[model samples]
Target: MAALVPFSLLRNYSPFMLARPFIVKGCNLNFSKSVLPLPCRRLPFSARATHDEQAAAKAAAATADSGAPTIFDKIINKEIPSSIVYEDEKVLAFRDINPQAPVHVLVIPKVRDGLTELAKAEARHGEILGQLLYAARIVAEKEGILDGFRVVLNSGPSACQSVYHLHLHVLGGRQMNWPPG
Candidate 1:
């Protein structure tokens, strides 16, 4: 273990003591250092979104609803086209139309059973919820992202849930960032 020197002592030491290369007895020691990037002075956002984008964002956040049918119903009933990834008697897994990642799939229960959102889930929903999560894993396996995948549930408007139906988004195929937006 390297010796621990107080930071105050660093200021008093010669500039040669704090260097990328510190030599001792004709032997050069290479020590790498990480320098944090300086804080940006620019605005937090690059540009303002257009009216349509703002409206869409608002709509995405307006799904704090219940006991309502959404587009997922049509997809479930085969009334609409969806690329089915995995399916069983209880749960259905399909590819997301607007995918956030290369391997993106949506998992949901065949019957809503009043489970419009995760926050509204009750004890009766335990079995189906487990099935949905299992189906998500099956989707990950089929999509070749079983090694690293994410299961996401947007419960309400604050979570950016556009559809009122309860569904899990299985995303993978790249490095996911921390503190997801």
Candidate 2:
């Protein structure tokens, strides 16, 4: 014989129109009373969101720009907190939020001007461009990776650059392999 569902579960939907019945395999066949297991309680909304979903939401919010102010602006203005390793009048170096290496730092020009990416650079950007590269070396020395390190710039979508503001990635602190994945 089929078991009758409890009134609490039945109240949420039409009992007759329900397609599938809740199956409780190991429980006793007593149907005179209703008892729900502890696991059926509602969970908080945050608990329901997966780690990937939360990361995607953060990435989406960070990349949703129309040539406007970015998180780097806040970092430059000292409005948002960042662990700065090196700073000069022309450039600033700070830790990357999602670091791919043990020692990962981002070197950027304090004044972005119109440089959203390396591809956007012009002849007038030569001075700041050199300054940024020099800052990267200073950062490597400060981080104690002077023996060896790597500098990278993801220019466009093909390179998987999520941030538009131009910046250089300085990575070290381990045996780095050639030809990055």
Candidate 3:
């Protein structure tokens, strides 16, 4: 049989309350208590296996593709759901579905204009390019991380840019390290 412990035994009663106790207040003290069994712990091997599977899934998702109309396109079109931070006629800033930092946001142009990657940027892309940078600043201000923030653009497979569409990553809310991994 399990032991039945009283709630009073868990803590000390206030001396002030004991001294000024009154019965003028009509209150019912009757109550019932119940104990719940602790949940079973998973086996170490099973737990490790589950963790490995999750890591593999995340890696596969992050390194999957490039230069195609990704899920972000759908998000831009309002066909998919995303936590938007800022939006203008030319640009859109939204929270990354998978955050790398406390404040991880992606800022992109509403129109691609064949800017599959930063490497493909031409002299004509100058206007929209400047607009994207300005949008990143707006996003940082809105997220309350204006004091300090980092903007990143992973270009091509070497840089681990899974999505081909041009986008800027704005990250903050923690001490940033130099020479990004």
Candidate 4:
């Protein structure tokens, strides 16, 4: 296994590495963008504090809580350059900023259309929903994960859906466990 690096190491490393976000497993290590503060003192990854209260506060502060614009809009508008995997008039597929597996991509719709989360979907959203799922397949194929893949859609805060925008996580390239945590 690759050795786990510390987020603080970026401060001493080159500036270029600090400018971009990278992930190990599903945890986001972007210090600049992280809402959960990293410990300044020496502590192992497992020993670091898990602030459930702080996490809850951050989730409550989610932008556009009532179905308004989210950061995904910026990616779709090309304002924020993403590592796009697949794109079309109706859907967009890009690598997850925080990946869960060797092959992890996020498939989302070009237009949210009130679909802030999968649980918000209505009859009118059926077509676009299908398109998003199909786009996940395209991403899986491009990433060469045809043997197996897991498509995950986190619908609410309880499911750890941090961003309010609807997204389908296409994860593969590893043996996934049942009864997902």
Candidate 5:
């Protein structure tokens, strides 16, 4: 197993910091805090599935959105075992099986209510949406990544909306690049 290097040693940012990178699982990942925050939007931003996330997207696409129950339903119903990070009456959060970041949690509504994807959300779904986003914040806080974290919602296959069920991915613990996919 790879030992964790202290973040304190890499606090001061420098271009040369890239040379002596912080090692995680044998990969040199820069945990710098120099990136700017994305602008706020009235609507949730759609996360595009990139190369690293293609497998998840493909698996999700294979299932499609035929108004069928998903694996999340199993998780919500206690049929699936998950490392739950947080849970409430309206939402449930748990660690991602295939995590993209050191801190990656998926927050979803306990009741799908036709919210197979963000695009399918109706006005009646407003309350659940707010609850989901708030739960994401709570997950970030619990994970000690509130200072810098990301909430991603992939709406469709093109955007890599895996599982059909609406879910918000709370990701942090490292420097996240812009133009996220």
Candidate 6:
């Protein structure tokens, strides 16, 4: 017998589609009636994203690679107050608003120079890219987690890159794990 998809599942797509029958494999499936169970099981934390994370990801997707001035620009210009950890001619390191680890810092270039994201990096951006990585190390050292730390760069919305400006996240202060989400 063919399986019927839940009308509830089709509600999000198109209500009119529920009356249509679709064939898959060797059986015809109708979406008007639900033969499957409702209320799916909760996924484990390691395989699931929290509500807040999901929301952030959606927001990131909306604004990904826009090439617009981001909050980091304000932080760099001193318009927005940030807990500055390190600053120099080219790079600025500060505490992250949403810390992923006990010690979390963001290392960004003072001037974006069209380096909105790592994927947008050009040959000329090699210098600033190196500087950002070096700044991450400095941040890790100053945070007293030089022995163990992780540097992460979420390139696009698919990678959860909320900020458009190219930046590196320096995280430490606790034991880290593999396959970091």
After the best TM-score superposition of candidate 3, give how far the Cα of residue 95 lies from its true spot, in angstroms: 0.5
TM-score of each: 0.67, 0.64, 0.64, 0.69, 0.71, 0.69
lDDT of 5 by residue, 79-136 (tens): 9999999998889999999776779999999998888888888899999999999999
- Give, for candidate 1, the lowest lDDT window spanning 10 residues: 36-45
Range of the 10 consecutive residues with the lowest summed lDDT in candidate 6 = 10-19
- lDDT for every model? 0.72, 0.73, 0.71, 0.73, 0.77, 0.75
- lDDT tens digits by residue: candidate 1, 17-55: 344333222234223443222223332222342344445
Q: Please identify model 2 stretches exceeding 4 Å from their true place.
A: 1-65
lDDT of 6 at 108: 95
Best by TM-score: 5
lDDT of 2 by residue, 14-41 (tens): 2222343343324544433444332343
Q: Deviation in angstroms for 62 in model 5?
A: 6.5
The clash tally of candidate 3 reads 1
lDDT, residue 171, candidate 4: 92
lDDT at 173, model 5? 81
Native-referenced Cα lDDT, model 6: 0.75
Candidate 4 scores a C-alpha RMSD against the true structure in Å of 10.1
Cα misplacement distance, residue 7 of candidate 1 (Å): 47
Query: What value does the lDDT take at residue 20 in candidate 5?
Result: 43
RMSD of 6: 14.7
Question: Candidate 6 residues 36-133, lDDT tens each?
Answer: 43245342233355655666866976876566668999999899999999999999999998676678899999998888789999999999999899
lDDT of 4 at 27: 51
Model 1 / residue 107 / CA error / Å: 0.2
Question: 1, model 2: CA deviation in Å?
Answer: 55
